[model samples]
Each structure stands twice: as C-alpha cells, then as structure tokens.
Target: MANIIILGAGIGGMSAAYEIRDAIGKEHAITVVGDGPVFNFTPSNPWLAVGWRKPDEIRLNVTEPLESRNIRFVPTRANKVVAEANRLDLVDGSSLNYDYLVITTGPRLAFERVPGSGPEGFTQSVCTGPHAEKAWLSYEEFLKKPGPVVVGALQGASCFGPAYEFAMILDTDLRRRKLRDRVPMTFVTSEPYIGHMGLGGIGDSKGLLESEMRQRHIKWISNARVTSVEQGKINAEQLDEQSAVLKTHELPFSYSMFIPPFAGVDAVQGIEGLTNPGGFILIDEHQCNPTFPNIFAAGVCVAIPPVEVTPVPTGAPKTGLMIESMVTAIANNLRDVLAGKPMKARATWNAMCLADMGDSGFAFIALPQIPPRNVTKAMSGKWVHLAKVAYEKYFLRKMRKGKADPIYETYVMKAFGIDRLKLEENID
Candidate 1:
C-alpha cells in the first residue's frame, strides 16, 4: 500500500484529500499535513474584511472532517521538503516518508517585497483569516476618522480579484454608513488597464469594471508600481506602455490595502527541478512534477506564467474553479498510476470567479484560463453577489463533510455547458 501525503489543508489540499480517498479507496493510506487545524475560506476574505461576514462563519475546524473520512491529519508546519529522499521534515523535528506527495500549500504572501506594506507595516491585508480580521479591526479604527482610502494590487501580484472585490465592498460599506462623502478612494494597480486582471481582461471585464468604478466615484491609477508605503502616504510610479515611468504620485490615505506578490511557501523553495524561480511547483499538463513524477501540485502553489506581458509585472491568477480542476486531475492521475495504468487525466485549467462588491458583484469564466481561449463570459449584477454568498456556504459545508463532489463541474459547467477534465487521448 502506498502512503500518500497531501500538504496544506486549505481548499485545494482538503479537496484533494477527499477526492484521492474516493478515487483510491481503502487500498492506500492518505495523510494530510497542514500548519493549522482550521481551514479558512479564502474567497470570503473580502467580505470578512468589510464586516459582511464573521470569522467563525468562514473558518472551519478541518481536523474532524478529515479524520472522519479516515484520513490522517498532521497539524504542523513543514520545515523542508526532502524530495530526493521522498521525505518531509516537520517543524516539530519529526520526519514523514511518503510514496507520493501532493503540494497544495498555496502562496506565501510576499509582503516584504514592498517596504512599509502588509499588516505589520502601514497597509492592511485580506489574504488570510487573521489578516482579514486585522484588516477589519484597522478598518473600524479608520471609520472613526474617515480619510482617503487606497486599494489595489502591487507589482508581481497574481490574484487581482480580491483587490477589486475589497475596493468595491469598502465603497458599499462606507456608503451604507453615510461616510462615503468623507472618504476619497483610489485604486492603484499593476494591470495596464482597470480590468486586465492578469488574464488580459475577460469578455467585457474592462468596460464593465471601469463603468462600475465610475458609477461608484472610485478613482483609479493603472500600470502603477508602488515604490513605498508610509504611515499615511503611498508613493507609486505610473508606467507607460513602454515600461517607462510616466509619473510619480504621492497619495495620502487613512486606510490602505494592497494585494502583495505571492511566492511558494518556505518549505518547498530552492529545490532543484522541484519549483520555478518564484518557488511555485513545476507541473506538466498532468499536474505531476516533471522531475519527480511522484510529486504533484495544485492551487496557487502551481506555476503558471502570466497570460501576457504587461507594462508592470503581473502574475496569472489561479481561481477556485481552476484549482478544483487541478485537484481533480491530480487525483485521477494518481488513481491511474496506482492501478498500473498510465496517467491520462488533465485539468481543464478553466477560470471562474464571483467577485462580490457588497451590494452587487461581477462574474466571469475563461475556458482554459490562458489567452486564445475557446470561451469567455462575464456579467455583473446583484444576483452575482447573492450567488457568491450561497457558494461560500456550499463550499464550507462540502469541506466540513469531506465530500468529493465536483462542484464546479456539476453546477458551474452545467450552467455554462462545459467539461472539467480532458484525457490525453482527447487533447488535440
């Protein structure tokens, strides 16, 4: 029997554990290693930051559910990944060996890339549960003395959805509190345009997002690289299409939140042939590492190049639907390999997002995620916001029960008339 170890118990990790268990059954042992026992619904972080959702509402004790599924749970951080030896060294000094390993550790918030940014610095973050909670606290303090607000993603940042979501949510909250008049909001982003979103804008995303911002009275600065952030001030260089600095702006704000760049966690960095320079795991179409076939990766930890070059550096996003496809593909491939069959399953790499803007929201889907896609759709309305709320609850419930349901495949794909996984023989 093979000992399969899955690292990181967030969305991708938890789903992988359940899917692999269902795929392989009782023939093998499955273990999940995570730094903590709780799993935070990361997509809901923007809502949590704005007081629309509580911490408990988005956090779940994953130990019980995973254990109930007959999966071993190790609540400890990994010190290092000894890939050559097929072993992992835990922070507690214990070592665990595995026949196969799946990495879903997600990205490490590279806040240090920008000085005087992140929670420890002058700016706030909604990347994690604790970070969002901190952002809420800081936001409450700022509410007492409302001033200018700044929100956007920094250079080399990958996930741009949350940055947009939080900005709009903050606007909705302030308007509800009758404090919108007192606060001047500005969006500073590395994207060349307002809705490039790293995938070069899906459907009418640019026009839709731009229209929304205009209607809400939120000003924006595109192709911006934050040079430094001070206590109440942020310095940025606006770049032209040729990557030349066109102007430098010294903006002042009482509240600020910027999505910092992401890198692979420390545990998996600097291993030859294991990860890219940015520390993200290097996987082929099958989601298996090129150098070590026994190793696989999914979620934000997987390396994907930017869709297109921008004036300022930007990384592609790995949306929930995209990660789900990755997890499913990995599980199916593992099952095939364990059965003495060649690995054939491949993730669709599709992208879908329900970006809540408090009162309203925007939804988009990009087939195959990369440019020159077969399909792309985008829309905005209040129903999208409601759908996001429902989706959060559904996802949390799925995690709590350890169900191996292909949610995106069943619901989302059916709605859009698409498929989730493609086999090697089927790919042209």
Candidate 2:
C-alpha cells in the first residue's frame, strides 16, 4: 500500500486530505501531522478580534474526522524534512517516512522583522487565535478611550485583504460608537497606490478602493516602509526608486494593527532544492516540487513571485480559491500517478476575490494569476456581502461534515459574473 504523509492541517492540507481520502481509500495509508490539535479558520480572525466571533466559534478539532477516515493524526510540529530520504522528523522526537509528501503549512508572519511589531505588550494582530484574543482586549481598551489609530501592512507583506478588512471594520465600529470623528485614523502600506492590493488593482479596483477610502476619511501614505514602531509613533521611510527618504511621524493611537510580512514556515526553510530565497516552496504549475517529484505544496507556503515589483515592492496574495485550485491539481495529479497514467495538464490557477466592505463589498476575478489572460472586470454591490456571508456558512458546514465537492468551486467561479469564465478553454 502507498503511504502518504501530509504536513500541516490548515485549510489547504485539510482539503487535500479529504479529497485524497476518497480517491485512495484503504488501499493507501494517509497520515496528517499538525503542530496543534485546533484548526483555525483564519478568515474569521478579524471578526473574532472585533468581538463578532468567539474563540470557540472559529476553532475545530480535526482529530475526529481523520480518525473516522483512518488517517493517522500526529499532533506534533514538524521540525525537519529530509527530502532525499522522503522522511520528516517531528519536534516530539518522532519521525516518519512517506511514499509521497504534501506540504501546506501556510505562511509564517515575520513579526521580528519590524521592531515592536509583536504583541509582547504593544500593538495587536488578528493573524491567529491567540493574537485575536489580545486584539479583542486591546480593541476594548481603545473603545473606552478613543484616540489616533494606524492600520496597514508591513514591507514585503502580500496578504492585503485582512489589512483592508480590519481598517473598514474598525471604521464601522468607531462610527457606530460615535467615535469616528475622535480617532485620527491613518491607512499605511508598502504598496505604491491606495488600491494596489499587491496584484496591481484587479479591475477598476484602483478607482473604487481609492474612492471608498476617501469617503471613509482615512488618511493614507503609499510606498512607505515602516522602520520602527513606538507606543504612539511610527518611523517610516518614503521610498522612491532605489532610494529612501527617512521620515518620522508621531500619531498617538490607542490601538494599531499592522500585517507583518509573510515567509515560509521554518520547517521548509534551508531545505536543499525545495524553496526560493524567501523560503517559500518552489513548485511547478502542477503544485509538484520540480526538484522532488514526489513532493507537492500549496497555499501561502508556496512561492508565487510578485505580479510586478512596480511603484512599490509587493508580493502576490494567494486567496482561498487559489489555494483550493492548487490543492485540487495536486490531488488529481497524485491520483493519476497512482493509476499509472500520465499526469493531466498543469493547473492554471485563477484568482477570485471578494473584499467585504461592511455595507457592501468589491469583487474581482483574474483569469490567470499571471497577466495576459482573460482577467474579468471587477464588480461590487451589497449583494456581494450577502454572498460572502452565505459562503462562510456553507464552508463551515462542509468542513464540519468532512466533505469535499465541486459545488464550492463552481459557485466561486459563478460569483465572478464573467461570461468568458463559462468556457473551459479560458481556465487552462
């Protein structure tokens, strides 16, 4: 029987396990290794931080489902991976060998890159459950005594959605509490433009996002590198091409949330022939490591170069749908390999994003993550917010039941509302 070892139990890994479980069945052995027992729903982190979701509401114990599927569950952090030996060593002093390995450990937030960027005592983040808890308490304190607030992403940070979401959510919350006028809000980012979003403005997103921020009365500074952060001030550098002009700005704030730059998990770092300089796993379009054919990777852990280094340095953001596509491609390829058939065409992942804007949301679709394809025109409306809510509910139900279906994929594609998407040729 073939033995499969999957690393990390996050969204991409869990979805791949579920898909592979049905495809390979008892004929093959599957094992899942995770650093912890709880599976965090990252998208809901912001809501939890804002007092909309509780810790228990977003946490799911993954042991039961894997047990039912007869998949081995090892609740231990992976410390080292010997790609040549096809083995993984765990932090708990155990090791396992595998016929095939899948890595989906997700991104590592480089908190130490920026001074005082952590939650040791100052600032807060909604990137994880513990961080969200701290953020909730910090936000409560801020509510009690409103003051200046700064929210944005750090240098080389690719995940822009959460930063934008948190800013809007905070604005909505402050306005609801009649404290919007009192809070001196500033939106800061490393992007060159207000709506760059790391993907160079999907479609009309530039105009729409800029207009929205203007309406919200949030001050912004682009192409700004955060040098250091103090209790009530920020040290930044106004960067032009190949040079920087140092500038320090003091703005006392009761609360601040800054998205840190993302890198590959330490386990994947320094591994020979596996990752890029940034430590993200390097995979072909099929999600298979070109250096190690038996290894595959997905999610934020994989290296996808920036669409353009442009006006400001920014990396591409891999959303849920994009990760799902990568996982699907890897699963299908594995199935083909087991069946002794040539692998199918490499996956051409497209990005579909819906950014919720409180009362309404903006939706955008990029046919192929890399340009020169049929990138759809971005659309927005109140209905988009309703759809996003429905999607969250649908996703939670599916995960709770340990089910994987194509319905979610089709639904996401339909949400793009582009006619060309109906054609199969447009996908590959």
Candidate 3:
C-alpha cells in the first residue's frame, strides 16, 4: 500500500484528503498532517469580525471527518521537509514517511514586513478564526466611540477580497449601529487603482468598486504603501503612475484592518529546488516539483506570478475554486500513478470569487487566473451576498460529510465551462 501524506488541515488540504480517498480507494493509506485539529472556514472570517458569524459556527473538527474516511489525522506542526527522503518531521519530534507528499500549507502571515502592523500592533486582521474573534472584540469596544476607519490590503498582499469585504462589512455594521456617520472610512491599497484586485482589473471591477465606495461615502487611496502603523494613526505613501512615491500622509483612525503579505510556511521554506526565494513552492503546470516527482502543491503556498506590475507591489490571489481544481488534478494524477498507469491530468487554474460587501456583494469569473482569459465577467447585487453565504454553508457541510466533488458542484463548473481536469493539457 502506498502512503500519501497531505500537509496542512486548511480547506485545500482537507479537500485533497476527501478527493484523494475517493479517487485512489482502499489500496493507499492517506495520512493528513494538519497544523491543528480543527478547520475554520476562512472565507467566513470577515463575517466573524463583524459579529455576523460566531467562532463556533465556522469551525469543524477535522479529526472525526478524516478518520471516519480511514485517513489518519495528526494535529501537529510540520517542522521541515526532507524531500529526498520523502519524509516530514513534525514539531513534536515525530516523523512520518510517505510515498507521496502534498504540501498545502497555506501562506505564513508576513506581519513583520511592516513595522507596527498586525493585531499585536495597532491594526487588526481577519486571516484566522482567532484573529477574527479578536477583531470582533476590538470592534465592540470601538462601537462605543467611532472615528476614522482605515481598511485595505498591504503591499505584497495577494488576498484583496477579504480586505474589501471587511471594510464594507464593518461599514455595514457601523451603519446598523447608527455610527457610520461618525466614522470616516478609507480604503488603502497597493493596487494602482481601486479594483485592480491584484489581477489587472477583473471585468470592470474598478468601476463597480469605485462606484460602490463613492455611494458608501468611502474614500480611497490607491497605489499606496503603508510604511507602518501606530496607535490611533497610520503612515502611508501614495505612489504616482510611474511607481514613485507622490505623497506621504499620516492618517488617524479609531479602527483598522490590513491584510498582510503571505509567504511559504517554515516547513518548506528555503529548501533547495523546492521553493523560490520568497519561500513559495515551485511547481510545474501539473502542480508537481520538477526535481522531486513525489512532491505536489496547491493553494496560496504555491508560487504564482503577479498578473501585472503596478506602482506598488501586489501578488495574485489563488481563489477557492482554483484550489479545488488543483486538488482534483493532483488526486487523479496520484491515483493513476498507483494503478501502474501513466500519470496525467493537470488543473485548470480558473477562479470564481464571491466578494461580499455587507448587504450586497460582487462575483467575478476569470479563466486562467493570470490574464488573456477565456471567460471574464462580473456581477453585483444582494443576490451575490446570499450566494456567498450559501456557498460557505454548502462547503462546510461537504467538509463535514466527507464527500468530495459532489454532482451539484460539477454542474456549477459545467455552467461556467470549467473542467475539473485539463483534458487537453493532460500529460502522457
């Protein structure tokens, strides 16, 4: 029996477990090495910050779900990866050997990049369940006295949707509390414009987002780099089109949330031939490292080039749908390898994101995430918000149910002309 080890217990890794189990069947032994015993729906974190979602509501105990499917679960940090040995060393001084390893360890928060950033600093974050819960507490205390609010993605940050969602959601919550009028809101980002969104403007997103921000009375500072944050104030540099700093501003704020940049986790960072200088795993189109055949990767941990250069640095986002597609491809490829068949199947890196903005939201579809898209469209409405919430509920249920690639999910992809595997790009 082949031993397959999947790293990280987050959405990508868990989904990989379910998909791999279904594809390879009982012949292979699957062991999931998760950083923790629970899985939190990360997309719902912004809702948690606004008190729309509770901590318990979005978390799932991954052990039972995984063990029930005959997958071994370990709740420990993966310290280092010895690629040549095909083994992983855990934080608890234990080791696990595997025939194949799937590295899905999501981004390590780069809070140190900017001094006085993150929750421990003057600003806030919703990157994790605990961080979201802390943000909620901070918001509650701020409700008593509202003032200027700053929310946006920092330089080198890839995930811009959550920053947008948090800013708007916080605005909604303040309005519900009748405090929005007292709070001056601003969106600060490294993107050249309001909705570049790290992907060269996805289907008029700039226009739509700018219009929405204007309607909400929210001002924006684009092409901006936050030098640092201090208590009750934020320091930033607005850049010109030529990527030069145009002006420096010291803006005061009663509250703030900034999405930090992401890098590879410690487990695989700095490993020769496995990761790039930024510590992101280097993989071919098939999501496998060229030097190490048994090593595969997906999600934010994988190295993806920025869509386009801008005045300030910004990284591309790897959406949930794209990660799922990668998992499907990896599972099929591994299954074929074990069955003594030539391995093929490559992931279609398309992205469909539901970006909620309080009562209303936006949805965008981008095929081949980088650019020159086969399909690019965007729509916005309250229906989009409802759909996002529904997706969260459906996904959590799927995780708990231990079911992978449900029929309805297939129909959803077919409607978008997205394939689970790259049929044309399959390797021999």
Candidate 4:
C-alpha cells in the first residue's frame, strides 16, 4: 500500500487528500499535516474583516471528517522535508516516513518584508480567519471615530484581488454609515495601473476599475514601493523605471491593510532542486517537480512567472478553478504511477474571479489570465455577491458532510463554456 503524506489542510491541501484517496482506494494510507485543525475559507476573509460574518461562521473543524476517511490528522507545523529520505519532521519533534509527499502548504504571508507591516498589536491583516477577526474588531472601534484609511498590496505581492475587494467593501459600508466623507480613503499599491490586478487588466478592466473608483470617490496611488510604515504614515518611493529615479512621498492614514508578498512554506523552501529563489516550490507545467518525481505542488506555494512587468511587477493570483485543475493533474499523475500506467499532464487553464464589493460584486473571466486573450470579461451585479455567499455555505456543508465531490469541475467548465475541452485534452 502507498503511504502518502499531504501537507496543509487548506482548500488545495484538503482537495488533494480527497482526490488522492478516492483514486488510490482504501489500501493506501493518507495523512494530512497542517498548522491548525480549522479550515478557513480565505476568500471570505474580507467580509469577515468588515464585520459582515462572525468568526464562528467562517471556520470549520477538519478533524472529524478526515478521521471518518481513516486519514490521520497531524495538527502541527511541518518543520522540514527530508526529500532524499522521503520523510517529514514536525515542529513538535514528531516524524513520519512516506512513499509519496504532496506539499500543498499554501503561501506564507511575508509581512515582515515591509517594515511595520505587522506586529499583531499594531498593523492588522485580513489574510486569515483569526487575523480577520482581529481586524473586524479594530474596524468596529475605528468606525466609532473616523480617520484616514489605507489599503493596497505591496511590492512582489501576487494576491491583489482581496485588497481591492476589501477596499470597496469598506467604502460601501462607510457610505451606508454616512462616514464616507469623514474618512479619507487612499489605495496604495505596487501595480502600475488601477486595474492591473496582476493579469494586466483583463479586457477593459483598467478603464472599468478606475471609473468605478472615481464614481465611489476613492483615491489611488500606484507604482509605489512602500519602504516602511509608521503609526500614522507610510513612506513610499515612486519610481520611473525608464529614467531610474526614486521619488519619496509620505501618506498618512489612521488604519491600513496591506497584502504581503508570498513565499513558500518553510518545509519546502531552500531544499535543493525543490524551490525557487523566492522560496516558492519549483514545478513544471505538469505541476510536478522535475527533480523529485514523487513530489507535487499546488496552490500559492507553487511558482508562476508574472505575465507582465509594470513600474512595479504584478503577478497573477491562482484562483480556485486554476488550483482545482492543478489538483486534478497531480492526482491523475499519481494514479498512473501507482497503477503502472503512463502519466498525462493537463494544460494550464484560465481563471474566473468573483470579487465581492459588499452589497454587490464583480465577475471576471480571462482566457489566459493575461492580456491578449480570446475572451476577457468583467461585469458588476448584486447576484455575484449573493452567489459568493451561497458558494461558501455550500462548500462548508459539503466538507462537514465529508463528501468531496468533483462537482467543482463541472461548475468551472460551465462558467467558461469549455466542458468539451476536457474531452479534447483527455489522454485515455
């Protein structure tokens, strides 16, 4: 029987465990190691930060369901991976030997990359459920007395969607409270344009996002490198890449929420022939590390090159659909290996993103998740917001009931109108 150890229990990790176990059957043993037992739906963090959802409503314990599957659950941090030995050492001094290891530990939040980005007691983040809870409390108190607010992504940061969602959510909330005029909102980012969004503005997103910001009376600053942040101001550098000049500016704010640059989990970082310079796991288009054939990576921890370079670089965010495709690829590869059959790697897919703007939301789909695509579209509607809420409820229910259906694949193909492409890409 194959002994597989999966790291992290987030969306990608959990999905990996489910897919692998179903394909390989009960003879194979699967164990999942994660930092915590709670699976936090990170996409809803922005709503949590804005006090739209309670803390308990956002978290679901993963132990009981995983236990029902006879999958061992190790609630501890993965300290290191001994790739040569095919083993993992835990932070609690425990260890495990494995025949195959799937490193799904998602991206690490590199808050320290920027000075004063986070010390827990000072600056706040809505990246995680617990972090969002803290930010929600702070927001409630901050709203009692108005002040300037700052929100944006930092240099080398890839996840810019949440920053935009949170900014708009807060703006809509403040407007409802009649404090929009009292609070000065400034969006400070490292991207070159308003709607760059790491994919070079799908279709006319640049015009659409900028126009929306103007309509909402939201101010923005781009091509900014936030050198450091103080109690009331952020020191940034404006660069003219062609001229190579750096101009400094000080922007004041009463509250700030900045998305940190991401790096690979410590367990896989710096391992020979395993990780990139930025500490993200190095995987080919097939989602497998070429040097370690038995190892695979998915989600934010994997390295993907930026589509384009602006004044400051912008990298694409790997959305849920893309991650699902990666998971399918990895599972199929492993299945073939165990069955003594040839492996097939699937092609990289595009992305569909739904960003909630409080009472309403925006829907976007890009063929290549970059410019010059066959199809790039974005639309704003209240249904998008309602759909997101319904999705979260349905996903959590499925997890609680211990049914990991491949229904998400159908949902994705339907949204993109590419269901037939799956058959075209099949290599049976």
Candidate 5:
C-alpha cells in the first residue's frame, strides 16, 4: 500500500485528505502534517478583526475530525523538503518518507518586504486567527482615541478580498459606535483601479465597488506602493500607467492594516524544479509537479501568474472555490494514477468570492479564473452578506464531519449552472 502524505492542514490540506480517503479507501495509509492542531477559517478573519466574530467561532481542533476519519495527524513543523528522496525533514529532527506528497501549505505573509509593517511593526493583520484577535485588541484601543485609518494591499499581494472586507467592516463598526465622524479612512492599493482585484475586474466590479466606497465615504489611492510605514505615518508612491511615480503621499493614521505580499513557506523554497522563484509549487493543468510527478499542490501555495501586468506588481488570487476544485482534481488524479490509468482530471480553476462589507456584501464568479473567460458575474446586496454568514457555519460543519463534498458542485454549480471539472477522458 502507498503512503500518501499531505502537508499543511489548512483548508486545502484538510479537504484533500478527506477527498483522497473517500477516493482511495482504507487500503492505503493517509497522513496529514500541519504546523498546529487547530484549523482557522481564514475567510472569517475580517469579521473577527472587527469584533463581528469571536476566535473560538472560527477556530477548530482538526485533530479529532481527521483522526476520526482514520487519517494520521502530525502536529509539527517541517524543516525542509527533500524532493529527490520523496522525504520530508521535520523540525523535531524526525523524517517521514512517502510514496506521494501533496503540498497545501499556504503563503507565508511577507511582512518583512515592507519595513515597519505587520503585527510586530506598526500595522495590524488578519491573515491568521491570532493575528485577527490581536487586531481586535488594537482596534478596541484605537476606538478610545479614533483617528485616521488606512487599509489596503501592498505591492505583490495576491489576496485582495479580505483587505476590502476589513475596510468596510471597520467603517460599519465605527458608524454603529457613533465614532465614524472622528475617523478618516483611506484605501491604498497596488491594483490599477478600485476593483481590478488582480483578475482585471469582473463584470462591472469596478463601478460597483467604486460606488460602494463613495457612498461609504471611504477615500482611495490606486496604483500605490507602500515605501515605508512608521508608528503613525505611512509613505507611499503612486505610480502612473507607465510605471513612473506620479506622486508621493505621507499619510498619517491611528489605525492601519495592509495585506502584505505572499511567498512560499521556508520548508519548500529553493528546491530545483519543485517551486518557482517565489517559492510557490509549480504545477501543470493536472496539479502535478512537472519534474516530480509524485508531488502535487493546491491553494495559495501553487504558482499562478498575474492575469495581466500592472504598473505596480500584483498577483492573481486563488479563491476558495478555485482551491476546492484543485483539491478535487488532485484526489481524483491520484486515484487514477494508482489504478494504472492515465491522469485525466483537471481543475476548473473557477473563482468565486463573497466579500462581506458588514451591512452588505459583494459576490463574484469568474469561470476559469483567467482572462478571456467564458463567464463573469458580479453583484452586491444585503443577501450576499447573509449568505456569507451561513457559509461560514456550513463550511465549519463540513470540516468537523470530515465530509468530502465538493462545495462548488453542491451549491455554486447548481446555482450558476457550471461544471466543477474539465476532463479530457471519461472516468467512472
């Protein structure tokens, strides 16, 4: 029997474990390695930062659920990946060998890319559960003495949805507390426009998001590259379409949060033919490594080029739906490979996002997640916000039960009339 090892027990990792178990059954051994025992629902981070959700509400002890499914759980950090030998070196000095390796280790927040940024620095973050909880504390202190606020994504940042959600959530919270008048908010982003979102804006996303910001009284600066961040001040250079510096702004703020750029985690970096220069695993359409076919990857850890070039660097986002599709494809392909059948499954790479703005929210779907897509739709409403709330509970329940249901297939596809996989050959 083959020993399959899945690394990084986050959304992609967890889903992959369950799906692979269902696909291959108990004949083969499945192991999941993670940095910690708890799994944090990353999408709910923005809500947690604004006091809309508590830490416990979004965090789950994944060990129990995974163990219940007969999947071995290793709660330890990985030191390095020995790609040539198909082995992994653990921080605890123990090594594990596997017949196949699936990498789902999410991005490492590159806060150091900008000096005086991130939780350790002057700015706050919502990238993880602890980070969001800390941000809440900071936000509470800032509430006592409200001042100018700054929120947006930095250069080379991939995920932009959370940044937008937190900005609006903060606005909603302040208005409810009758402190909105005391704070001035500014959004500084690397995107060329308000709603480019790294995929070059879906449907009328530009107009919809811009209109929302205007109505909410939130000012913005696009094509911005944060040069440095001080205790109470931030310096940025606004670039023109030609990549020339249009202007430099010295903005002051009492509270600030910026989505830092992302790179591959330390363990998987610098391996020849294993990862791109940025440290993200390089995968083909089948989600399998080109040089190391036994290795596969999904989620933010996979390298995907920017949809289109911008004056300032920006990376395309791998949304939850897209990641789910990738996980499903990898599991099915592994099953086929083990049976001596040619790999035929391919991820649809569809992008679907629900950006909650506290009182209201925006939703979008991009088929294939790349430019020249077959379909694109974006809309906004209070129902979207409610839908997001329900999704949080639904997804958490699924994780706890170790259910391997394809969320896009069960909900999104029927709702939008889309398919989850684009297979070249038929498979039972």
Candidate 6:
C-alpha cells in the first residue's frame, strides 16, 4: 500500500485529494496537511469585501469533509520539508513521512515589495477571507465619507482577476449606496495596458476593459510600479516599454486594494533543486519535480513562466480550471507510479475565467494559458455574472461531498470544448 501525502488543503490540494481518493480507493493511505481547519472560497473574496458574502458563507471547515472520506487530516503549518528524506516537519512537534508528496500551498503575498502595502499597511486587501472581512469594515468606513479610491496590481504580481473584480464590485456597491459621485476612482496596474491582464491583452481585452472603465468613470494608469503606499496616498512610477520612467505620480485615495506579487511559502522556499529563484516548485510537463521524482505540485505554488514580457514585470494568473487540470495530471501520474506502471499524463493548462463585474461579467478562454494557443475567446454579459454565482455554489457543494470534478462541470467544459487532460491520443 502506498502512502500519499498532500500538502496545503486549499482549492488545488482538496481537488487533488478527492481525485486521488476516487482513483486509488481505500487500499492506499491518503493524508492531507494543511495550515488551518477552514477552506475559503477564495474567488468570492471580492464579494466578501463588498458585504455580498459573509465570512461563514465563503468558508468550510475542511476537516469534517475529508475525515468522512477516511483520510488523515493534520491541521498545522508545515515548518519545513526535507525532500531528500521524504519527511515533512510540522508545527505540532511531529513529522510525517510519505512515499509520495504533493505540494499545493498557494503563494505568499509579497506585500513587503512595496514599503507600505497590504492589509497591515496603509492599503487594504481582499486576498483572503479575513482580509476581505477587514476590507468590508474599511469599505463601510469609506462609505461614511467617500473620497478617492485606488485599486490595481503590483510588479511581478499574478492573479489580476481578483484585483479587477474587486474594483468593479466596489464601484457597483458605492453606486448602489448613491456614493459613486462622491468617490474618485483610479486603476493603477503593473500591466502595460488597461486590459493586459498578464496575458498580453486577451482578444481585444485592452479595448473592452478600457471602454468599460471609461463607462464606469474609473480612470487608469498602466505600466505603473508602485514604490510605496501611505495613509490615503500612493507613490508610483509609470514606465515605458524601454523600462524608463515616463512619469511619477502621488495619487490620493480614501481606500485601496493592490494585488501584491506572490512567492512560494517559507516552508518550501529556497530549497535547492526543489524550487525556482522565486521559490515556486519547478515541475515537468507531468507536474512532477524533475529532481525529486516522488514530489509533485499543483496550483499557485507551481512555477509558470510569464506569458510575455512587459515593461513592468507581470506574471500570468493561473485560473481555477487550469489548476484543476493540473490536479488531474498529477493524480494520474502518481497513480501510475505507485502501481509500477509508466507515468504519462500532461495537463491541458487551459484558462477558463469568469471575471465578475458586479451586476455584469466577462469570460475569457485561452487553451494552454501560455498563449499561442488553439482557442482564444473573450465575452461579456449579465449571464456571465449569474454563471459565476452559480459556479460558487456548485463548487462549494462539490467540496463538501468529497467529490472532485462533477459531471455537470464536465458538460459545461464540453460546451466550451475544454477537456481536462492532454492524453496521447488527443494530442496532435
């Protein structure tokens, strides 16, 4: 019997655990190591910040559901990982040994990159549920006396969707309360353009987003590198394609949300041969570490190259669909390895994103998220907003049931011509 250890019980790790449980059954022991007991529906954090979702609504006690599946659950921070010994040091004064390990611990928000950024700093964040709740409190206070608002991403930052979503949602919320006219909003982003979105302008996204921002009366500054943040103010430099500063501005804000750059968590960072310079796990096409064959990774912890170079450094955001596909690849390959069979499965790495714009939304599809792909699409409508809401409910329901990918989700993907795996037969 093989003992499989999966680290980080967030979206990717939980999805991997469910798939592994379904594939390998009860014969093998499955253990999940997580930093905490609750799993937050991260994509809904923007809603949480605007008082649309309560803390309980977006969180699930992870232990109850996983224990029901006959899986071992250890809720503690991982202190260190000894890859060579196949041992994981935990915060609870114990270590777990495993034949195979999967790391899905998400990024460590690099708020320190800018001197006065993040929730603890002058600016606000909606990256996590607690942060979102805090942001909502701040939002409430802001509503009392509306003024200037700034929202955007920092250099070397991925996950631009949430930043964009939060901005629009906040705008909608303020308007609903008849406070839009009292607030002056500005979008300052590391991306070279309004709709670059770290994927180099997905299907005229530049034009579409620019138009939408204009319609919403949200002014923007792109290729902006934020040097520091202060109380009700931000200092930033706008750079050109040549990497020369074209302008510097001191923008004032009553509230702000900046997506900081992400790096591998401290537990696994700086491990020679295990991670890249940025501390993200380096994996082959199969999601297995080339140097540590028994090690695999999924989600934001995995390193993916920037889609294209920008004047201001930007990293591509890995959409949830793509992360789930990575889970499939890693699960299949791990199953093969433990069964003494040749491992051969690759992730589709497709990007299927639904960006909620409060009452309206936008959806984008880029097969093989790295660009130069076979499929590329971007659309917007009220249906997209409704679809996003439905997905949140369906996804949480699936997580509660210890199910991986549901059948209806498959049909939805099929309608979009998306498949999770890149099998040998399916590949050209």
Off by over 4 Å in 1: 410-428
Off by over 4 Å in 6: 406-411, 414-428
lDDT of 1 by residue, 221-310 (tens): 999999999989999999999999999999999999999999999999999999999999999989999999999999999999899999
Backbone clashes for every candidate come to 0, 0, 0, 0, 0, 0
- Name the better of 4 and 6 by lDDT: 6
**Candidate number with greatest lDDT:** 5
- Write down the TM-score for model 3: 0.95
- Alpha-carbon error at 152 in model 2, in Å? 0.5
- Where's the lowest-lDDT run of ten residues in candidate 3? 419-428
RMSD of each: 2.3, 2.2, 2.9, 2.6, 2.6, 2.2
The reply for model 3, stretches above 4 Å from the true place, is 406-428
Error of 4 at 332 (Å): 1.1
| Model 2 lDDT on a 0 to 1 scale | 0.80
- Which residue runs of candidate 4 sit more than 4 Å off their true CA positions? 119-121, 241-243, 406-428
- Tens digits of per-residue lDDT, candidate 2, 5-26, equal 9898988888888888876667
Q: Taking the tens digit of each residue's C-alpha lDDT, what string does model 3 give over 18-124?
A: 99999999878999998789899899999999899988899988898888899999999999999999999999999999999999999999999999999889899
- Candidate 3 local lDDT, residue 422: 40
Residue-level lDDT tens digits of model 4 in 1-428: 89999888988888888888887888889999999899898888998998888877878889998988888899899999988889999999989999888888888888888888863534678788888988888898898888999899988889888988999999999999999999988898888888778887776777878887888888988888888988888888877765254688788888888888887777887888988888888887778888887788888888888888677766678887677778878888888888998778663556668788888877777776666666667777787787778777877787787756553453344433446464234311
lDDT (tens digit, per residue) of candidate 6 on 1-428 = 98899999988888888888887778999999998899998989999998999988988888878988988899999999899999999988899999999999999999998999999998889887888999999988888888999999999899888888988998898889888999899999999998888887778778888888999999999999999999989999999999999999999999999899999999888789999999999999899999998999988999999988899999988887778878988889988887889889888776767889998987777665776766677888887788888778878887787665732253245433444344212331
| Per-model TM-score versus the true fold | 0.96, 0.94, 0.95, 0.94, 0.96, 0.96
Which clashing pairs does model 1 show?
Answer: none
Error of 2 at 190 (Å): 0.7
List the pairs of residues colliding in candidate 6.
none
Error of 1 at 46 (Å): 0.9
